[model samples]
Target: MANTNLKHSSPQGGRLRSAVAITAILSLYSASAMADGGMASMCFFITYMKQIVGSVAVIAIFVWVMGYFEKKAVLADIGQYVVLGCMIAAMAGWFVSQAGLVPPSCSA
Candidate 1:
């Protein structure tokens, strides 16, 4: 039989599928936001980034908790780094808002 194992063993297919799915979802979201209005587009972009950062923070907290329980020094160190990154992201977002890079979407 021909070497079919090599073709089946590659992870490229899975990666490609994931890439395509993410691209499609992002494109759809962008298109919908654009259809809404310029303000909506800007707000959507900001909201999306905030959500992504928030998600990373949550994941980091989870890792930190797991590391604490397991007593793995390396994992705990990585968790600290992730937490720092989350803090930086939050600061950057705040800075952008303060700088008026984008108009405020919601009223105080």
Candidate 2:
């Protein structure tokens, strides 16, 4: 008799899943932020783009800082960091946009 069991799964697969989940969540959040006039009003394309780009940059910086301090090279850790970073950045962007920081030219 032979036993069939799965010994292991790829680490990257886990990271990929985490990243996808975070991306979807953040995307929905962004949409809601716009729908409710929570961030940049989202009525204009340029403003939306700027908000997304800026938020992404902020998130990446935060994630990089975490990577630097933890010295953890694990994919799961990085994935978690990425999720946190994006959430924080999205919140920040939403605030900035709501505060009327976005230019009028950006309004549609």
Candidate 3:
């Protein structure tokens, strides 16, 4: 009789665990790389992120309007994208604050 207790090795068995471990290692490496700059991430979040969000909002509105006139998009379908853009623009400040990236004071 053949042994039924033998474990069969599969090609996909460890893929998920390997991926998670690799991701964790990469995350740690990136975090360490960013650690050298101290406030670098904060500065980037404060200065560049706001501008990016605002630009996205402007672009979203422009595209939505253009599509509306061209008859390529329905009003109902486009509302979500426009609303999301506006919401992101509106919340840019809050998002920055949440990221804890207050710029250094000039008094120093």
On lDDT, the leading prediction is 1
Off by over 4 Å in 2: 1-6, 38-108
lDDT of each: 0.83, 0.66, 0.63
Question: Model 2 over residues 8-90: C-alpha lDDT tens digits?
Answer: 66678779989999889768866776776643544444455556766766666676666767886564466566667667766
**Against the correct fold, how does model 3 do in TM-score?**
0.44
* Most TM-score-accurate candidate: 1
Prediction 2 global C-alpha lDDT: 0.66
Give per-residue lDDT, candidate 2, residue 76: 41
Q: What digit string (tens of lDDT, one per residue) describes model 1 on residues 1-108? A: 754676675688678979999999988998999999988887887788788888998998889888899998877888899999989989987887778786767321
TM-score of each: 0.70, 0.34, 0.44
Q: Best to worst by lDDT, what's the order? A: 1, 2, 3
RMSD of 1: 4.2
Candidate 2 has a TM-score of 0.34
Model 3: residue 6 alpha-carbon error in angstroms? 39
